[model samples]
Target: MMLYIIDSIRTNNFHGEQMMGKIRTLWENASRKLEHHQNNVYGVYNDYESDYRGDYSLSIAMEENNGEAFIEITSSEKYKVFQVDKTDEQGMFKTWSKIWKQEEIGLLERAYTYDFEKYGPNGEIEIHIGAV
Candidate 1:
């Protein structure tokens, strides 16, 4: 899949609950002035300062020929996909945190590249972790 996204930088160090709050706020603001062409939105992290902090960029889906300014992202390679159901009261980020804490399974994240979240229409979330 391909995405045409509006970019922003998130530099806060908040983790867990605090991070989720910030993420909601960020998505609200990022999408406020934009139009949604698809049911799924994406949050792409291109630069990682550490495990839980980085320059986070949010983007809504758009057509390839849409005459708007956007960063184009294409899912051309294999990535590890993690799902968060809409029915889960704890939400996507919290579920991600829990997954991140499980290091014994040996699923190493490719932090050098971009990682992203695909938010579905039914509120389901598919987190694509860049993997080596």
Candidate 2:
């Protein structure tokens, strides 16, 4: 499906540049730019130049285009889903840490196409990693 992205950035996990700070700012700006009415919002990783270690773009998006920038992300047949409790402030990062660890050890064969985080309406979360 296609996602209407509120904001976007190109960054990589390597290189001294911080992903969290940039992502936080992107979401901050996006929240101010549009009126969100979706049951869930998505953090979509796309435009992959290579694998997870390579540069990619992250967008805060929803189902409707609403004249905003958008990207197409489809659900794959195989995935690794990580659930995060809404109350844990660091749950998001911790889940990502676990994902990276698995990828580092050859546990995750990534698709390098689209990975997304679903922020549920009830405040729960699921990090979906595309698998090859």
Candidate 3:
């Protein structure tokens, strides 16, 4: 998969920008800039210093490069997918918490590559975690 970035932030979930609303703010700003797209937005996670507990680069991106920064994932790569519950107000956060817990317990092996959240045009959402 290849994506063009609208905005990016370097952050870790613990003792980082998440609690300070940086993630939320990035998404908000990116959302506005993405209005001309096809309604499909991606939240890309990459450049992991270590793992989820470490700082990583997160970008709001789309398939059309639009002359912006971009990331590409190998075609044969694998991922552990988490479908978001659109009805849950804390759906994204809850799902991410689950991913971290699963990884910690050895239930999931993360690749620390290019993970992504796909927000589809039809309101469906899924998180694709790069897997080993």
Candidate 4:
């Protein structure tokens, strides 16, 4: 089974923080109704045209690894890669494992966060939140 996934990224610093916070608020607001159990994928990518808030567009995948979640970020750019895995007891379901790692300037960081959704069967909707 494949799930529709929406991915997002956040940068460090005040401006990035503000954008991240706003993105989180948007997710929480919609999550109340968007929550599902059909299993969906999640990932992030740099929007070369993201000058405006809507410039960053989220992607939806219909075919992918089952219960697998992937997340990646490209250097010098906002490109990110992610996969969602719900079958493993330690991937998405486990918060610790779901978290990715990052290190910059000799400091450890979790560059981005990934999550999954399974909203009813055949549920199709446009991704509204996620920007970096």
Across 1-132, the per-residue lDDT of candidate 4 in tens digits comes to 333333334443234547657666646644553455354433333342432222343333333442244334223333222333445554432422233222223223322322223232544322221224
Deviating ranges (above 4 Å) for candidate 4: 1-14, 48-132
Residues 76-105, candidate 3, lDDT per residue (tens digit)? 999989999999999988999999899999
Angstrom error of the Cα, residue 116, model 2: value is 0.5
Candidate 3's TM-score: 0.92
Q: Rank the candidates by TM-score, best first.
A: 3, 2, 1, 4
What pairs collide in candidate 2?
none
Where in model 3 is the C-alpha error above 4 Å? Answer: 17-20
TM-score of each: 0.68, 0.85, 0.92, 0.29
TM value for model 4: 0.29
Question: Which segments of model 1 are wrong by more than 4 Å?
Answer: 13-22, 34-36, 53-69, 72-76
**Which number leads on lDDT?**
3
| Tens digits of lDDT, candidate 1, 8-98 | 5455445444665666676677666445545567777665665555444444443444425555455665577787866778777576775
Q: In candidate 2, residue 27 scores what lDDT?
A: 87
* Residues forming the 10-long window of minimal summed lDDT in candidate 2: 67-76
Model 4: worst 10 consecutive residues (lDDT sum): 95-104
Candidate 2 lDDT over 1-132, as tens digits, reads 778877788988776288778978998887775455656788898888887778898888887766357777655457789998668888887888899899999999888778899887777899999888
Candidate 4 has an lDDT of: 0.36
Per-candidate Cα lDDT values, in order, are: 0.61, 0.81, 0.87, 0.36
Candidates 1 and 3 compared: the better one by TM-score is 3
